[model samples]
Target: MISLLLVDDHPVVRDGLRGMYSADPRFEVVGEASNGAEGIAMAVALRPDVIIMDLRMPGSDGVSAIRALAERGIPSRILVLTTYDTDSDVVAAIEAGATGYLLKDSPREELFRATEAAAQGETALAPTVAARLLGRMRRPSGGGLSQREVEVLELIARGSTNREAARRLFISEATVKTHLLHAYTKLGVNDRAAAVATAFSRGYLSHDNNDE
Candidate 1:
């Protein structure tokens, strides 16, 4: 069973989460906290496999708590659970060492899956959150992105699959991936969809272009 630590400011929220976990045979709510500071203490003491964190709290916000636990070399993976899904919240939680970021309204099964993924030290992000993060990254400066990277991103933005992109570009699929990866680095994104979105948003790729 996956061991869990829930940390939220509201008693009712904690109660609801505890009940959800209690009903699942695959998980157990090992501890609960009302704020980030308490959550950090309990997480370190209990050493649960995963900690369900909240971003906004009365004291020691979730981002700070996540950073503190990471600095102290705690092994518990933190999975953020809250109502906020803004770009700032998602990015801060992730940069502070959160394993996953899921909104509170997520389906019960998704929450369970996110907790499981977090326990295993995997990165999990809500679909909308992921999109926002990818699309919201800052653009590179001084011609940081390569011409090939722009080409690949443009094709991707135009609804081309990797194979199709490769065929159109007359490059190998591996080459396409390499360009995409480079574009991701330059665009500060993690995936192809995000790269394309960022590219368009940053004017690296335009909709009225014909560069195939």
Candidate 2:
């Protein structure tokens, strides 16, 4: 059986996941954490094969915990299980070393398969999430921003400095700058403000939220 740790802020979600996994003969629900902080602690203590993490939480978020686990060289494969599927959310989680990304609404059988795949250190993305990644890969030359570039631009639009964006994205400040430069080139802008403005104008970013 694949050992699993369920990490979600909602007790109901956690309980439901626990019940589902508990009924499965191929899996074992080794632990459940109400938030990312406790999830990381339990992960360290239990050393489960797979960790099903939620993105947003009360204290530390899932991405932060994922980065912490990677930094500490934890062997558990992180499989994000959340209701969010925004570009920023998906890109950030994957970039932070999550082994897979699945929506909370995924079918039970799909979740089971994804958990098994994650335990084996394989990528398992929800269809919408996979389509987004694939679209980023297939973006034409100079047509649009790459996912990383978009992420950088979104952070900049939110008033994040290079250092802050780098920290949030788990990349170097220099790398963040490079992404900004690439975004500028793609958007045909000469500076940060222009890049953000143009991206918004071109619908690359939403007026309400860059991630949308």
Candidate 3:
């Protein structure tokens, strides 16, 4: 049987999870905690196979606890079970060494499977969370900026019009526009001026590059 720990701030939620796993023959609900800090202490004491963690709580949020568990070299795999699936929350949990990310609305069978997978040290992600992670992976790696994006922004920052940049770079004006659009998305800006400014502030473009 897979030993499990349910860590959430809500008593009802914890009761529900404990009852669910308690009914399963393949699992054992070893313990429960109301917050991350308590969860960490129990996790150290019980050393369960899987920890189902909730991201937000009144004290010591899940991400911080996950980081702490990792820093202390805890061997149990963590599975985030939370209501929040925003990009920041998902990324932070995964980056902090969570083995799985599942939303609170996940079906019971899905949660069971995820818990099992996490026990075996496998990745289990909800569909939306998986798509978000895939999108992030496909984006440009460093600061989400590509070489072409930097070139386009550099030219625009140096007072080159789209047509002029196209002529100088031997690409079509349409291509210049495309590059600028990509840069704007990566830089989180709406226009050429804002993109250039954001890129320069982020070191994706430099004064020396503008001079060139």
Q: State the lDDT of candidate 2 residue by residue for 1-212, as single tens digits.
A: 99999899899999999999999899999999988889989999999999999999999999999999999898999999999988889999999999999999999999999998998888999998897776555545557777798788889999999999999999999999899888877777899999988876665665556543
Best-performing candidate as measured by TM-score: 3
Between prediction 1 and prediction 2, which has the larger lDDT?
2
User: Which pairs clash in the backbone of model 2?
Assistant: none
Which candidate would rank higher by TM-score, 2 or 3? 3
Model 2, position 79, has a per-residue lDDT of 98
Models 1 onward score TM values of 0.67, 0.69, 0.70
Instruction: Show model 1 residue runs off by greater than 4 Å.
Output: 141-212
Clashes of each: 0, 0, 0
Q: Residue 96 of candidate 3: its Cα lDDT?
A: 99
Candidate 1's residue-wise lDDT over 7-78, tens digit each? Answer: 999999999999989998988999999998999899989999999999999978999999999999999999
lDDT per model vs. reference: 0.87, 0.89, 0.89
Total residue pair clashes for candidate 3: 0
